[model samples]
Target: MRIALNARILQAPRTGIGHYVAELSQALSCDAQLELDFFHGWGWSRQLPAAALPGYNKWTTLAKQVPGAYSLRRQLDQYRFTRGVSRHAADLYHEPSLWPLEFAGPMVMTLHDLTHVHYPQTQPRDRLAEIDRRVGPAVERARFILADSQFVANEIRQHYGVAAERIKVAPLGYAERFRPREAHALRACLAQFGLQPGGYLLCVGTLEPRKNLAQALRAHALLPEALRRRFPLLIAGMPGWRDANLAPELQKALASGAVRLLGYQPDEALAELLAGARMLLFPSLYEGFGLPVLEAMASGVPVLLTARTSLQEVAGPAGVYLEPGDDQGWCAAIQRLLGDQPEWQARRTVGLQRAQEFSWKRCASITASVYRQALE
Candidate 1:
């Protein structure tokens, strides 16, 4: 079997879909019966350079600033890249994200989430429009679809009218590096950010409306002054598209030294950062799988995630769930998680056990089965 994968997402720092593509590709490459070809670039661009550029998004943002650049790139990918896919002579093309680049072969697309459909307000108008136009056609063309969670699979079925038989739920896998780290081993990395093991709360996600950071700030501020001083909130993410306002209240909390924003921590430091944190604050309004929650659990850290969306499926009984907009509830949960060591330890143990259930090897095996089905 031969497969050509849309590996362009790997050019940027490994976020949700990027992580999926990279990990699955690596795991799939190990399969003796399958030949894997990674298509790292599209349109006029044929491949990514040997070096991994850490700030690839900066260039992408700059390109988007140029009027009509987005449409031109899409056109080139649609027209020119179709030929590239043909040249690979792939038995199947797997797009790890929503949009597939004009492949006529049996294509499988992973629709991670319908956030654009559920919460259109979370994305920019132009981007929403683009998704509306492109995603529908992509769905129509794909022989099969992959969903990160059952929550998203149902969304696709209901909203896009995709047949239930056509969509498969392929849960994400966390890297081995995300497991627990010793305090001394992580001391040097933690010290750079003024973080002490089990001393500070952490939030990891792109700063945007869907992440619900505003409510998190409010909840953090609701903490008693002594608690706030004892454990500050550390945010680690790059700014994503949205008008998720940093309200005056959050600004006040930030100014008072209860919050610190560490934008876009590199992958090398991610394991240490996650392990050192007291708890992962991920009160996302929505998610497909909530990878950070899993990573945190795997790191032996308790997570406070929203009860809504696909979070419950990933977190299971291991997570501490709260309503997305319940600042008071969030504050109380944080206090208990930090102050009560026994409870924290219990959650931590359960989380580690739960995290063990997922692996990229298993993901690859399932994916290969899907490819066979697609080919059939």
Candidate 2:
């Protein structure tokens, strides 16, 4: 079967969805039964673009500030997509993001989360408006829908009334790179950032309101002065929307040297970062599937996460859970985990076993089946 996929997300620095697309595309390509063509916004190609073009981030940021820029860009993208579709015929088109382009073929879409719907204030006005306008119609247009977890699958049924049969829960997987590393092997990579193995706590995600990082910073600050000084909280991600709102608290944390912001580490560096951490702290308010939790688990690190949304599903029984709003609870949990070596070791062992259950190869196998089911 010939498959046309929207690969436009790869044009930017990879976050959750971009990694999904990149990893899934590579896995799907290995399937002998499939012929894949990627629609890279303005053109079609068989090979995926390796990385973001130089200056694409600056250009996108600038474009978002200009009036009517998004609409104009969308129109041009549609024109190019329509023209590309006419030239390269395919049996199905799969959209790995919320908004799928208009397609008259069998369509498959991956709804990563309902964040825009559930937390409207988390999004910028224009982006939220665009999602509000497009997502419902896109859901209606898709023949089959992919959700990252059962939590999000239920959200789809509740919010959009999409039937359970039509929606498939295809959990994501960690890349092979996210495995445990020895202290000796990780020391050099960690040294580059003045980090040491098992010497720092990590929180990995874009800096956004939905990530609830301010809460994490607060919890870290509540640690005893010596504890905070010994194990600094390391945040690894790019600056995202509404990050300025976090300034007051973030500034205080940084001033005390209890928090370090390492913006958007590359995959190689990030994997080492994850593997060397004392533990991974992820207190996201919501998630479709908390990929960072899975990645941390895969790296044989204990995870402390919010006790809500798809985080529980991703972490299984391996995570140390706390409520998002409970600052005192978060502080206590961190203290207990730091002091209890046996508990940490047990969690790490179970996390490694749990990580073994997920892989990109399995995800691709299931996705291929979904494609065939859509055709039927």
Candidate 3:
């Protein structure tokens, strides 16, 4: 079958969704039966992990710089998409991000999360509304819907009233890059950031409202004076959404010398930090799939996370669950994980084994199956 994938998320320095697209696309590279064409709505200024596909095509003006995001602009940019997409004609177009927009051909969509629905304040207004207002009915445009988890599948049904049969859970997986790193090598990489191995509790994600960064920072500041000295709190990933509100709060925690804001560390350096950290503190308010939590688990690090949200479904019993917005509760959980050795080791081993069951190849195979299902 000819399959056209929406490659917009793969166009930049990959974050959560970007990494998902990159690894899954690369996993499809070895398959010969599938005619895979990536729809690059704009010029290819950025690099994707996959080698150049013989069928890949791009718009002369590039979708990134295109002015018509909603109408003529987006359509004109992806005009090639309407012209069948590949040599055999696309059996289905797969938009890997939330909504599959304006595809000329029959399509399937992967709704990664409904954070936009449940936590509207965390996203820009227009983007948030478009998902529910448009994509809900737009499900009829595609042959089927692929959700990252059963949590998200339920969410799609709850928010859109779409039938459960329309959604299938194809839970995501961690990249091969996220794994254990050598201690000395990890230490060297940390030194460049003026950080020391095993000296910090790590949290990875954009500094956005849903990530619950403000509460996490306050919790780090409020931890027992003695415990604070033992492990610094490190926040990684890029600054995104309502980040201005988080700046002053982060500054106060940083001044205490109990927190380090390492914005957007490279994936390799990030893997090392994960490898050697005391533990991962993931207090996200919501998630479709908590990739970092799994990445930490894959690297054999004990993880502290919120018991609510879709994260619980991903981390299982391996995660140390705490109340979502409780600062004192976060502090208490961090302490118990760091100060108690027996509890920490037991959770860490379980997390590592849980991580082993997830992989990109599996994600890709499932994705391919979704495309075929869309066609049938």
TM-score top scorer: 2
Task: Provide the overall lDDT of each model, using Cα atoms, as 2-decimal numbers.
Answer: 0.83, 0.90, 0.75
Q: Candidate 2 — worst ten consecutive residues by lDDT sum?
A: 122-131
- Residue 226 lDDT, candidate 3, scale 0-100: 77
Sort all candidates by TM-score, best to worst: 2, 1, 3
Candidate 1: give its CA RMSD in angstroms: 2.2
Candidate 1's clash total is 0
Candidate 1 lDDT tens digits, 132-197: 888999998888898888999999999889999999988889887898988999999988988789
Q: After the best TM-score superposition of candidate 3, give how far the Cα of residue 25 lies from its true spot, in angstroms.
A: 1.3
TM-score winner between candidates 1 and 2: 2
Q: After TM-score superposition, what is the CA distance of residue 139 in candidate 2 from its true location, in Å?
A: 0.7
Question: Candidate 2 — number of clashing residue pairs?
Answer: 0
Winner on lDDT (1 vs 3): 1
In model 2, which runs have C-alpha deviations exceeding 4 angstroms? Answer: none
TM-score, candidate 2, is: 0.97
**Candidate with more favorable, higher lDDT: 2 or 3:** 2
Off by over 4 Å in 1: 42-55
Q: Estimate each model's TM-score.
A: 0.94, 0.97, 0.88
Better of 1 and 2 by lDDT: 2
